[model samples]
Target: MSDLRDAALVSKAWPFEEARRVLKRYQKQPPEKGYVLFQTGYGPSGLPHIGTFGEVARTTMVRRAFELMSDIPTKLICFSDDMDGFRKVPTNVPMQEELAQDLNLPLTKVRDPFGTHAGFAQHNNARLCEFLDSFGFEYEFASSTEYYTSGKFDEMLLKACWEYQKIMDIMLPTLGAERRATYSPFLPISPKTGHVLQVPMLEVNAANGTVVYQEPDGEKVEIPVTGGNVKMQWKPDWAMRWAALDVDYEMSGKDLIDSVTQGGKICRALGKRPPESLTYELFNDELGQKISKSKGNGLSMEEWLTYAAPESLQYFMYLKPKTAKRLYFDVIPKAVDEYHQQLRAYPGQDLKAKLNNPVYHLHGSDMPASDMVVPFSMLLNLASASSAEAKETMWGFINKYAPDATPESHPNLDAAAGFAVRYFNDFVKPNKVFRAPTDQEHAALADLALALSSEEAALAAIAKKNAAMGNEDDLPVADFADDDFLQSVVFAIGKNHGFEPLRDWFKAIYEVLLGASQGPRFGGFIALYGVKETVALIQAGLNNELTK
Candidate 1:
């Protein structure tokens, strides 16, 4: 196993080497005692997808690197730019889909289906925050709405309008020709009309203190916008954010090639060096195009968490360089399985002696082993079928089976509780989505149920079965890994309860009741779902099978 920090270095190409170096660069040293702030920003257009985290998580990596590079602690900040008037609605926005018919009006005036978040900005911004929290990151989150009203970027805003535009003219041609045309040399807003001056975008001269509004197919009119100024347009916003936030590093996707290139101009204009940036790849769902929410296709980070472990995500983040393109969810399950293998193999390997090599970071930190946990889909099935399963209830079960299970204090237990509630409410899929069971699967499950008649019996059965499964030996799967643990879990539930050892019986319990067999311990999960429904699922499924 290579060091985790050295994970992405496969090529000798300049860009690849530079990225690897940037990834390994020192920010922790003394002359720069200031905390390394790795920043992530998103335009509050709509619900942010996994790609959003793709950037933030990379920022986390840089922060993690800084922590490792020296004694200096690094901080990660995710900025949500909610103040920017909606650019053409994101392809993910549902309401904006219809509103594009209105020619990309201000999102404020448009009706958004997703409530709780105010306007397009608020709606999407809320989703991003919720997603970020899911990753268990510790960071200060700031919204542009707050920053704008709070006047944090006031100076940068002023500079963008005053100085950013001048830099854009110089930088735009370098990015491409179309950019030079679409971008206004300066932000044109009317203090009087309080509307963006679009047609004659250049009419209002904040310099001349003049407001010019031109109606479509109408003569140029003048309107005044006094208080409505944020100054610089798009690139300026990027520049000002970099300087104001003191961001030493930020990660943007390849999609922002132009904006990032232009952002450099704005930074130079602000008389500051642009923060270090890495242009990572964009992700498309299984269909292989960019993930789009409005298209009803994007697998949100919420969805990813439902199916994959956080460490799986962390590993997948660097499985390829940020410059490469196209990642799919289908790849995660296997990677997660392999990640478990590496985690188990890392501790005993020569990696410990290789610490001086600087690649020790690629392998994860030392930890006790666990079993290969099942996919999120399976868990959803198990959880959905059995309603009583408390998350900690399952956690408690794992403690009984696995040796290293130390319970968190009561406060952290609250997190598991919340996770259970949401897990059952939103994420669990219906029985219809299940890939039909195979004869071998059915037989193995029944055999597993029989083995579960008692803990010792179940363990023995798993040990026997381990001879056949890939790398399923005594080695623990991962942090949450526990294949044998799960086997005992389901068996225990069936033998103790009336759930029985039959295929139809367990299937019903798993389908309508538990979202997966390979999930939280059946006993604890059953307690959360309750005895009646758990029993009912077993009884009803058998009845349904008999009738069919």
Candidate 2:
């Protein structure tokens, strides 16, 4: 294990790189807090999105990496800033009028539109926990409401009262003249109207742990900063949380790079060092716009799981996190196949190599074998070619391609097969356009079809001959299900027909036969879908039967 840790110290995997950053924080002395704390903050203004899950998932990867490299105990906190003021009612939720009436109140004070939870933020917090729980993430859930109301934040709140000017000096320069004029570190919860007042401070009584603010009716009110009477503005609150909790590590999106910096300075102002941090690039929608939780334009956790397994979503979150990537339905198939590809490769990887493999970071030492005898992309192609409406239809081809596999024995593949059919019907089926093959393409496809027909006939003839000679048990029959052989045959036909770049042949086959511009390798498709079935498909394409 020590040797593996030595290798992990220099492993190029992003998780290891991040874990190294956290590990380096304590080279001089271990944390006085006894355990390293990792936190991911969530704003419960809206329902939890894929972005929220990404933060926790990515943080867990780094936490797992740190576990491998250090003997120190680690803790992950998924903190919800539910005490944030409910500035505006989200358009995505129900009971908009009720939410509108609760403006300026802390989120935990707003009514849950869904009528399920105690408050709006509570509803979202429950959802966030449920989402994280489904992924089997090990983390403690914390609420800003509880922290503030329960007096967990009292010590930090009082400290901020004393360092009020210093923290303001750090925050004021970053805001506009107008915002700075009205800004105060402490937003006192209004006792009269139940709103979190964002007014300028009239006075700070640090010795008494209280702040005085002018109410809208021109009355001055002094409230203790402790016991939920006040909440710090976001920037100061972020730093205060770190300082109070002695957080060792946390991460946020690149958009918060400035926030991280501002928070760090404020933490220093409060006489505590900021935790080690990583800034990951944000996810964008299919249109390349940044995904927003309120706009509801991006894929949700539920939607992604509908089309693929949760592990595939984890794989998507795991890859190139520093680089921005599109999060949409179209990207799911690739992530699913690539995740399985890594799973299949994990057993062959040595300790050093395994440290870099994503599956290792995802599942740790309990990584499961890849049961996907068929790739996800190939399954989609099968679904398209078969016009499959059900997993059973796709399984018919799967059963023939891998005789030993079944839905019961290979659950991942079975799940993927079901996902493929749903994906095909929803996405692939709608946009598919079959084009008439060009003359050259038509000739090559015809020849390939003829070749497949001949191969099938030859196999049948050999079977008949053996059966007649009573040599069926003695004679070895030629294998018609050879994937490489079928692939080579298609290649030869394409080359013989003078398709300049032979890839054009395959492309044409896809466009003409499958109503797609790109598809799985034709031979593998044939091996899976069967030679005679592929021949029928080709014949249909040649007759323009499919275009109808």
Candidate 3:
């Protein structure tokens, strides 16, 4: 839907200016130690959505830049409010009385009826942390559960609630929402009577005394007046977070635009410095709703690592400002396409380079990288192998065609490739989605079946004779540009040989041979074994004993 030039990383409307010379007032600090980055992610009712990590990942680039910007340590802190009561049920996980009772609250206090979390909020917090680290996010993580239980943030929370009245006045009107009568700046559940109530706002009483919220139901509340008492509401909390952690920048989704509005007001109320806020529209599914784990509509970042490279995904994130409009989820397909296309744009050069340079941000995320359809020959050869062989084999080919798949071609790919391979295995798996033959290609399958049944072995010998191909790693790199013979046989064999292409081929080969398509590349992959072993792979698939 966009005819925007690739030069702008898909910014059709406005050109991005990554060249801001002067740091804002709040961002100023000693050159040796750069901005301290802190971001919020994880109630962890289930796994974090792509949107959640999107914020962290975007912030990471800034941190890395700051890492280069500073001589001293640049830090990122990922805070998880695991102590919050579970607000709602996550799909696929069972909901029960405990969940209903704890609804509209943080997840740390909820009971996992599915029996996975095992009667604790801490388990889900761990899951969220695991998920974040899995996405290659570098963060110093903290949990609200630990923070509160250990009294690490008691002063802050107490102060915030103490100034609850003033904070509420500024925050509510800013968001245009009225506070509920029963709502308190803080929520308290009576473990004894199962009564949930909010304390009434405390009056300062014009005296030197600690004031706290009083409930209409008759419980008198008070607080100790002396300490480093400072409080802020949600709106002001944003600014306070910046001042507290010395945040340089933060990117939030549009859903938080109102919160930021409210937050900005709080900053003014508290007379504290606020962090600069950048807003990206939330990534949504085809149904056009925000991707949320609670709604079961969001896919995890780890789920995305499969089927596409992480750099490609990262490239996808950077192509446009996170604050842009129309941030489509389907953009990933475009992202993938551009990655492949860029690889093909300069065949024989290290393809991983395509993922490295800032130029990698040229397209959207969902697109496949190349237009050079994976020669059916390569896919067929791969499908007729075992998972280990297929994994080894395919990675070899990808590393050859697209250098970004392995770190040997480019060191940055080292961590990224390992993630890509494992993500595919765990999330997508060898059998996740089948590469079905096209309807227009009906004759192809029948002809392929014939080729396999007859004249196949002798032809296989001919294919072997015509080929010295190993894993892409071992395949002799050459300018085979005009080599029609090599191309012909490769595609032809694919037409008559394997049922799966690159992805499924690896998956099926792994399934039939090693029981998974997730090892090394195929060119060198087949070499680790040999033709006889490769032939056995094809036979195994025909026999349908998958687990074997």
Overall lDDT per candidate, in order of appearance? 0.53, 0.89, 0.48
Ranking by TM-score, best first? 2, 1, 3
Candidate 3, residues 218-266, lDDT tens digits: the string is 6655544223222223345355454445554566777788777776665
- Backbone collisions counted per model: 51, 0, 61
* Per-model TM values vs. the true structure: 0.59, 0.95, 0.58
lDDT of 1 by residue, 1-548 (tens): 24433443443322334344544444344325366667788765566766777777666655554554345466777887655554565565556556565333333434566655446566666667776786677788887656765667665555554563476566666655665565553444434444444442545455654445454546565533323343345666677778777666777777788888777766777787677777777777676788654454656666656655566666666555555545554565555555566565555665333332222233325453534333233334343553435665545433433345344433222333334435555534332333333444444445544444444655655455455444364732312133445534465334433443444445644543233443444545444343344445544443344123
- Give residue 518's lDDT in candidate 2 (0 to 100): 91
Residue 79 lDDT in candidate 1: 81
Across 228-281, the per-residue lDDT of candidate 2 in tens digits comes to 998888888999999999998899999999899999999998899899998899
Shift of residue 500 alpha carbon in model 1, Å:
41
Q: Of models 1 and 3, which has the larger lDDT? A: 1
Candidate whose TM-score is highest? 2
Task: Count steric clashes of candidate 1.
Answer: 51
RMSD over all Cα atoms, model 1: 9.7
* Best model per lDDT: 2
